[model samples]
Target: MITFYDFICPPPQATKSGNTWKTRLSLNYKGLPYKTEIIEYAEIAQLYKKNGIPPAIVFPNGYAHHTLPVIKDDITGHDVFVVDSLEIAKYLDKTYPDSPRLIPDVEDVDAQIQEFQNQLNGAVIAALPVMFKASVPHISENSQAFYKAARVRDLNFIFPDKPISSLDDLQFTPEEIHATWASLEQGFDGLSERFGGKNTFRWALGDHITYADLILAGLLLCVKAVHGEDSPQWQGFMTWSDGKWKTFLDNLGPYLSEDN
Candidate 1:
């Protein structure tokens, strides 16, 4: 069985990291027999150090800190260490050819999935504050301090000065929140067109659970982690966009794998 090293929050109910979820999605999608090892915030560097995941001069690169999802596959005799969610997915699909594929074979379809992954990442960054605020409390106190500082840096990029020292101190008007979500909407460019006209996509690729679907679902799951299943954030987003976002989330009901 593959040993999937993933992140954990305070009660450890769900794997909060979107990247971790992506790896988990591929693992489950392939029906791989993998067990999880929960790694805390401070332990990320330790994981790399112990596993000897040395920095590489390779194209995809390696160990750029904050590396949370690392997998160890011992089934192939010697241990094989893999990091980064996308690479992990590609590796799993390539190694286990008999299983369902996360990445499709067609070049154009694969390109579309890659495009959606980029968009989902952009959306997550634009809506970072909301995700961090909801997630901060569940982290270790030590990690909470670091997470807040890091989020403040990220928030400053857009918010400018007036650093947010705490989640409680973070303030955004309803209009401001709407604007952030508006930015996130841009990340979904061609997605909504599939359902009807505006803000409607039944799936990342109509009816198929591709890597794009996993990535998109992972982005929303980050938000869901902050506020639970029926979060007000989801409701507010739906209200702002004529229930488009809510419908998208609802459509992804089946692919909700919680743990790492």
Candidate 2:
């Protein structure tokens, strides 16, 4: 049986960092039988030492790397280790080669696929620290220092560091949050134009879900987690491009059977 070992203090439900959910999405897509081992992110160090991590699929033949979404082929003793979600999808595309193709045609859609991956990774990484810090319960001086000087090697000042305690005290002030949300709104709106409208039966590119949809779903879940689903910030953004985004999710639903 295949096993997925993942982090626990997961990101927004059904988000990428929620490795369990990510694994589930792929596993279900392949209709594979698997079990999950949920461990705290802190425990990863220990698991790695033991080499029992699931992504490092340990088959009858040998062991694999400690990556997420690893699939152990007990039959041929093949241990497939896939790290990136997009790579995992591509691997599935190759292995299955039928039913749900997670990518577009190689010759025709490779450039677009690369573009979507680039934009998704770059934009999300840029926005992540802000979103993560904003979701904390209470921002500490150390936490504030970490984020402020995050891009820098070090902060000029130091405070007794402690985990964030409250969500309300996240880095941004109410004014700052509002401003940031406005910027995100504008960016996503412009982004919608480039990708086509949300829920439009067209995924980020045109027609059919791909890596773009997976990454977007993960990122959107992050945004929705920090900002309530009903928040004015995300309200207009989700369905803006003629409900195109919503359409993508509608079609992609079965891929994430449990989540939807």
Candidate 3:
């Protein structure tokens, strides 16, 4: 059995973190049996420390940043905790060689996929303001306070043109929001073109699914989960780039289950 740690959000928007979703998708893709352990935003570090799981990253200031998408694997006959989605996927693949590989075994394939993910994530930045705004109401007050403080301390540069002392300050004008969405759509279009045009390929690397596909799907699922399938944000996204994203996500439907 595997204990997958994910962050918690209020009803109507449960499981909104894209980083965690990446691991969930990977686990499901490999047919791994796991249960979710939902942690609040402020409790991540404490829980990790208690379980002897190390932080995902550490800053120069010595602050250890513990994050979700961590998995405690019991199938290996011992408690092996893997932090970070990418690391968890790699761990799963290494431990369960019989399962389909998420990170391809080909030489340089993993590096290529990582580069693709990096570029793809750059495109997602434009949409962050809107996505963050939509997520505010669904977060608990305590978590909200925690995130607001963390943003001010570590992510004040997100809005360099203006000061962001509070989460509300992250908001953008209606025009800016529209432009951001348009920019994201263009990014998706460019990604599709790189892989042989829109709707031409079912997965990131031709027919077989890989970590690259999960990376993209994780972001899309986060949007869908946070904004709701009926919201204009999701509706517009589904139709973007001649419905390429919609088709791509649909192809991943079998692995989209939330087996909590």
Best by TM-score: 3
Leading candidate by lDDT: 3
For 25-106, candidate 3 gives per-residue lDDT tens digits of: 9999999888998878999888888988777888888978877778898885988888988888889999999999998878
Can you list the residue pairs that collide in candidate 1? 192-200
What CA root-mean-square deviation does each model show from the true structure? 4.3, 8.0, 1.9
Candidate 1 lDDT by residue in tens digits, 92-137: 9888999988877875876786676665565556677766676787
Q: What's the ranking of the predictions by lDDT, best on top?
A: 3, 1, 2
- Tens-place lDDT per residue, model 2, 180-209, is 666665555656655654433456776655
Q: Over 4 Å off in model 1, which ranges? A: 55-64, 108-110, 121-125, 149-175, 178-190, 194-202, 238-254
Query: Would you list the clashing residue pairs of candidate 3?
Result: none
Candidate 2: count of backbone clashes, pairs at least 3 residues apart or interchain: 18
lDDT of model 1 at residue 228? 70
Error of 2 at 143 (Å): 14
Estimate the lDDT of model 3: 0.81
